[model samples]
Target chain A: MLSESDLGALAITLKLALLTTLILLLLGTPLAWWMARSRWRFKFLLEAVVALPLVLPPTVLGFYLLVALGPHGPVGGLMESLGGRSLAFTFTGLVIGSVFYSMPFVVQPLQNAFTAVGRRPLEVAATLRASPLDRFFTVAIPLARPGFFTAAVLGFAHTVGEFGVVLMIGGNIPGETQVVSIAIYDHVEGLEYVHAHWLSGGLLLMSFLMLIAVYALNRRFSVVQP
Target chain B: MTIEARFRIDRDDFSLDVDLSVPSRGITALFGPSGCGKTTLLRAIAGLEYHHDGFLKVGDRTWQDSDCFVPPYRRPLGYVFQEASLFAHLTVRRNLEYGIKRVPAAERKVSLQQAIELLGIGHLLERRPARLSGGERQRVAIARSLAVSPRLLLMDEPLAALDVNRKQEILPYIESLHNDLDIPVIYVSHSPDEVARLADHLVLLEAGRVTASGAISDMLTRLDLPLAHGSDAEALIEATVAGHDEAYHLTHLDFTGGRFTVVRKELPVGSAVRLRVAARDVSLTLEWQSGTSILNIFPAIVDEVIADGEARMTVRLMVGGVPMLARITRKSASVLGLKAGKLVYAQAKSVALLS
Candidate 1:
């Protein structure tokens, strides 16, 4: 009993999730690597800020993001001055909000993986004549492969399930910014039980399968130390 | 050629202050007990440990000074850590080639094939480090270090982590490295047996300080040092294989001082060998004793005699030019009137041939 509009929402949700995961990975890798290896006294403060979304209610994050990305806000004013439109209530706004909501999901595993790779291997690389940058790429990245896999799956899945953040920052708009979660909410609000049942059940199966794949793949990819 | 290192490192629990000038050839051992700063010194030389106000010069190149410091990767040196920390992800061949591929082709002193052949790791090239036994892994580690063709090699207790059997298996490879390569090596070891067999020059460290440094034979027999006072007190001598006595199943080795007929060895004639004669195994005699059970009897001139205890004393003697030590009861020393420049004969119970 799902309409064509509902299918459009599901496709947008998948698009947003995939794009956000990719962006988060690109921006978060160096940040997480620094947090894992730096000896600076104030590094913990940055760590706490990255971890805020994990404990903060998603609605609060969404509200703050909404205000900052609106027409009157700093970012929105800058966009207008540059002859562009405000990001609020746009697909881009939803991705930005989802990335924030899922920041910890991508960074925590990466930080743990980088830290677990201790300094000894890097020292060995130095003695073997590997430059610092070469060591990071050839040694650290390969050793932290499991963390990359976990972060990718978790960021994508968590972004797909986002409701509060998306609803606040990206107001529901058919075929534009309406994701599957918001579509299900709209169906329930309109008292259309049959349509809501199909969408909700589909999301349930999708989320469960995504989680199963993450766990199964992680267990298989983890390095077995002698 | 020479290597000069002057450094002072201040740690929370310990401090290392060393200034040394060593020849840039052969194996020079940094010998001391654990926690004696031997490894700290080696790390500083390799540019791995940055001590403030450090100065290092290898040949004419200044590796580290007040205004400039060369990082480990840029410095042409190979360091073997106490553990054979081979790259776990790479196969043995890849690990060996890791350093070889980094240096410019013109600067590559040792080829991949040469390193593999030197360490005898040709058969294990395809194996992963995890699958290797301890001895095999250490050999691969050594081969990997040599692949870079470093100007200087620093080995920090390379055999400390191996079992006795494994140590025996790896010692020959290390000896061959000393004999075959022209690269200068700085080896750190606390085991006297290792120093006795491998080190040509000795740098004795105590409490983060260099106590003594010189040729191995002189360092081992210096009575002023604690090395000569232990239960294992012995003297090292350089000897050449003269010939084999097939009838008696003995090998006659000639040194500057005298000739020693040792139990038959497999070494070919004319090969240089080292021998260690323990003080306890040498007995002093004022005259040549005929019909004695001992086979090693050499004419010696008493060099020095020191009272060790109320009833015991130690006598140092020079048999030809090689130094020999004897621990005699004070009664025997007084009866023989042993003194410097006194002529005597030394009867050795046994001699250990070390090559």
Candidate 2:
């Protein structure tokens, strides 16, 4: 049986993942759309920056974010001057770390999907008197639905399974920042093999189910256009 | 009213430069071979291809000029692409309604029901585009554009993507649009047959320039143009139904030259129709021949005779002020002593009833 602290950590982990996935979707959509459509010569620079997280070590990202959110750092200094405490080791700091860590997971799929949606549909829509914004909502978004599903699933799963970034930013406080990975780590450290086995197995099974669900659903829903 | 346009487009390998003025009624076909910039001209008229040195005035509205440019969505025009670019996620009904919803209430002139009926696509309303064949998809595309009630319609080789049978199936729908609607259509086509059957005005483009622009009747028969010399060369005759003889299952048609005997049709008397007489089907004689099987014969004067190849010649004839063409053997031409301004009788082997 899992301890009370294990349950708390599991709840906190799911909560963090849900919020982080939601935030990534909201912020990454416009950025991905611009990346897909813009004809700027230096677009590759932004593309490389967004893809950095995919190849980057989570600890490196966590280390920079920790400093940025720590007191005397730029962001933390600004917060301090504005009558707020430093953000490091807080839930908000954890969310920020998770967003940066899982951003490419959400943005890359969307960018590919948007690019795959060639300009013909949009041009046809325009000739039919649909404005630019109207075409995006009615034509583009609906056509890229499979990408949305893949993004949401990958973003949620990646954020949920994260360990290093959270360790660097979160203080592993109970009912606040402690998550499933940290809980398993603590159990193993304390020689609690049974608890570690339960948490680790549960995480593995849940992630596998998520990926299966996404792939099956994606295959079922056709993009409807060639 | 007239539509006038001047566009100058500079590209890496090709360029288009033209100044054109065409009447703002019926169908005007941009007829050319491939890569002659006919599609580019159509796009410019629709405001799809933005040219810095461009001028367009349709009726009284200035869509593009030196100081002003209207985007494609704002212009009162509908454009059909080479492919049926229907939204895959939407049903046929929704696709048809997409343009209708964009136009303001006061500007919606063609109702959705009318467009649906015109294209004969009511059975396809609930189906998605993926479920339709190429011909049905094109029909939906045409209907969708018509439902917008555009002041002008631009079609860039709409049937170019379909097969021969599919084109035949869709041609009647396109033909019905001109007869039933008052909107002016600028159609781009590479097929001379399509231009002959559909367009009232013809704009011949070559190497990104206008070689000739005039009525289809004159353009098809003008020996100076390529259309007059090809194996597909045919003269268009505007005739009206005079009478039908039930005894022989034939119809009598009256044109500028004389009366024609053709297979009986459902068209009523006094209704306007078009006739296509191929150059190869016509043979010229010095005087009218009697007791001949050919019933459609007219007294014509040879206007010009040009060598088609080493073996044959193409003769341009004036049949009572209307132009007609004849392709005869060079040996026969010399044997009959055919020449310019010589009186002759042109016997049409057969005349095809168009529209």
Candidate 3:
């Protein structure tokens, strides 16, 4: 059986993951597309930056983000001056943290997908009298379908299971920043073995199902169309 | 009216620079060897080569100039790539409609039905490109381009990706476009057979330069050009179906030169067609030889004679103002006394009907 706090933590974790995944998709699409297609000589520099979250320690990223959202830091200072509270230790802070923590999981797959679409289809559309924007929507998006699926699933799952970034920036708070991973950590630290088992087991099953869905759906897409 | 274009493109490994003015109504073949910048020139005319510097004037509309540039989508033109790059996700019908929907209704000149009927692709409209064969896909691709009713059509080796049988399967549909549509075509090809069959005007390119450009007949017969000296050198003749000899199973084709009897063909009387007479298949005689097996014998005047090598020479003959080439051994030429202004009989042993 779960406590009320456990359910609240689960709900918060789901909500955070959903919001973070949505934001990543909206922001990462064009970024990934540019990374895939642009011919700039220094494009690899931007690629390296986007991939930083993958190689860097999560606590290092979270430490920097925490300072940036703290009361005296640039973002938090700007927020205070704009008549808003500091973003540290809040639900919004957790959302921001998870977005950065899961950035590579969403962007890398989308970039690879966009690259796979290639220049031929876009050039074909152009010759057929389609403008650049029209070609991107009509040709590129539909062709990169599998990439979107992988990005969304990986983003959501990675955010749901995040521990270091969430802990550093979003201290555990019931109904706010108290996500599933943090709740399970609290249970283990307090010697609540049974409670930890239930949340940990549920998370393990959910993550496995999400990954399975991505692989199975992506394979089907490749087989049916490609 | 004519299409006047001047383009200069520079690349690390190659460069293209040329200025041309071609008739706006006939099939003008940009003929060249592989890596001869033929496709690059076609792309420049289509506005796909963005970094090129030049001017493109298609009739009254200027697609590109020093001060202005019209992107490909804004230009009223159709382009068919080497491969039939139909949108894999869309059904054939949707692919055909993709460009038509972009053009306004009043501006539409070619209806979707006309394109479908022209390419004979009515049955494959509901199927996706993946379900089509190579020839079928290319036909659908051509139809998709024609659906937009473009004033100019550019094709870059449209049959290069297909096998020989597939090329034969798609050639008739392409030939029909010349008869049924008024759009001027800039066809890029390396195959001499395709150019001889389809082109009225020829632009020869070599090493990113325009080697020759003129009427196909003139270009193919010019002694200075490589085409005249090649072993496959031939003459193109535009003819009409004069009559059919059912008793002998032969078809009579009447051209400006004269009538040619070939194996029977199922064609209506007065239908226009093209004929290819290879130079090697033609033999010159001092007089009309009676009782010869050859059926096409016409009185020809020797316009020019040039020694091909020590053993052979090519004789250019004029029959009723139409030019023909006859390749004969130097011994035969000497024995027959063939020279300029000499009256002779050109006996054509084989005439292949092109269309």
Candidate 4:
């Protein structure tokens, strides 16, 4: 009795998670690197800002993102003027919201990883004639591999399980923006226990499997290093 | 060829101001106590630290000058940090090749095989740095640096993190590097023994200033420098193995001034060696003693007798044009009427053979 709408929601959820993870990686890498290395007087200010999403209620973040991506908001107005539509109630809007929702999950791990790498290996690379970019790729990135793994897994899992931000921004549009979490919620509201069981159980199993993979791989990596 | 550097770096607590020019073919040690800015000076020379007014010219090329500075990667130099700091992600072979592959083919002077063999790290090539012993990691680090075929090599207390056994194990490779490689080295160290054994030139740093800079021999025996006043005060003499005395199980060595017979060594004849004659080990005699147990004796002319605080006098002597130090009580100096140009005999209790 599953409808096309349910399958579309599942696909949208996967796409949102993948896109959010990608965007978080691209935007979070340099930010995390800076957070790891900067000794600036106001460094704590930035750290506090990045960590705000971690402690704040997801609904609070969703409410803000909705406001920011609405027609009157700067981002929405910019997109509107660029010959597009308002980001609110769109798949793109869901991705932007998920990226914000999962920002700390990706960045904190990467930042800690980069910081744990210390300055010695980088100095050694420099003396070995590796340019700054070359050193980052050959030394820092490889040494911080565990951090990347953890970040990616956490970002993906966190985005996949997202509900409040998607509900606030994407408005649960069928075939376009309804994600798996919203689908499960809708099924439960309509008193469809069987559908809710399937979607919620799938998400629970997926998240658990992802976490198990991270812990297992991270343990192996650490043992290899040790 | 010479490496001339004039660096002035101002920090919150300390400032490094040094003007040094060392020959481009020998190991020059930056010797000092902890927090003396020796590492900072070396980092500046390597272009790893830029917060300073620095000028560095190596032979015909200018590495850093006013308004012109080369980054570390472009400066054609290899630097070894205090810790081994090997790339954790790369295996030993990849670490060695990291710089080797970056250099232009024509400029690669040290082959990978040669470097691996030189540092005795051929067996460890397949292993990551995490799996290595402290000594093994340091050796690989050295090999990695050497593979770059740098014009200069900068080592900042490369053995500071090693234990005594590890230091002994790595010292020979470093000595060979000093001997075999044509690249000049600027080595930072606080250990006097390392400076004595490895350095041809010495830059003495104290309180962020160049206290003294010269050939190692002159720097070690200078009555004005702190090196000549400590328990570690010793004279470094360059000598060549002359021959072995089969009957007495002794070895004959020749220096610029005279000859010395010490406990035999296995080195081949004519091989150059360095000897450390500690000031405490040297006994002053006004006349040549015939039957004393002390084997090595040399006729020396007193150059100066410095009053070492309290009742002792540090006697500076010129033995066949080579300076030597003898520590004796002021009473002995007065009784012997020791003065400048007074001829004396120096009987050594022990002489260390350093190579």
Best by TM-score: 3
Residue pairs of candidate 2 with colliding backbone atoms: none
Highest-DockQ candidate: 2
lDDT of 4: 0.90
> Of all true interface contacts, what fraction is found in model 1?
0.49
- DockQ ranking, best first: 2, 4, 3, 1
Question: Which portions of model 1 miss their true places by more than 4 Å?
Answer: A191-226, B309-311
Clash totals in order: 0, 0, 0, 0
Give me the TM-scores for chain A across all models, comma-separated.
0.96, 0.97, 0.98, 0.97
Assess candidate 3 and give its TM-score to the true structure.
0.98
* Local accuracy of candidate 4 as per-residue lDDT tens digits, A134-215: 9898888889999999999999999998888888899978999999999988999999988888888888999999999999
What are the runs in model 3 whose C-alpha is more than 4 Å off? Answer: none
lDDT of 3 by residue, A132-215 (tens): 999999999998999999999999999998999999999888888899899999999999999999999999999999999999
Query: Which stretches of candidate 4 lie above 4 Å from their native place?
Result: A1-3
True contacts kept of each: 0.49, 0.78, 0.55, 0.78
Q: Give me the displacement of residue B113 in model 4, in angstroms.
A: 1.5
- True A-B contacts kept by model 4: 0.78
Q: Is the docking of candidate 1 incorrect, acceptable, medium or high quality?
A: medium
What DockQ does candidate 3 have relative to the true complex?
0.67
On the 0 to 100 scale, the lDDT of residue B60 in model 1 is 94
Interface RMSD of 1: 1.4
Of the pair 2 and 4, which is ahead by lDDT?
2
Error of 2 at A112 (Å): 1.4
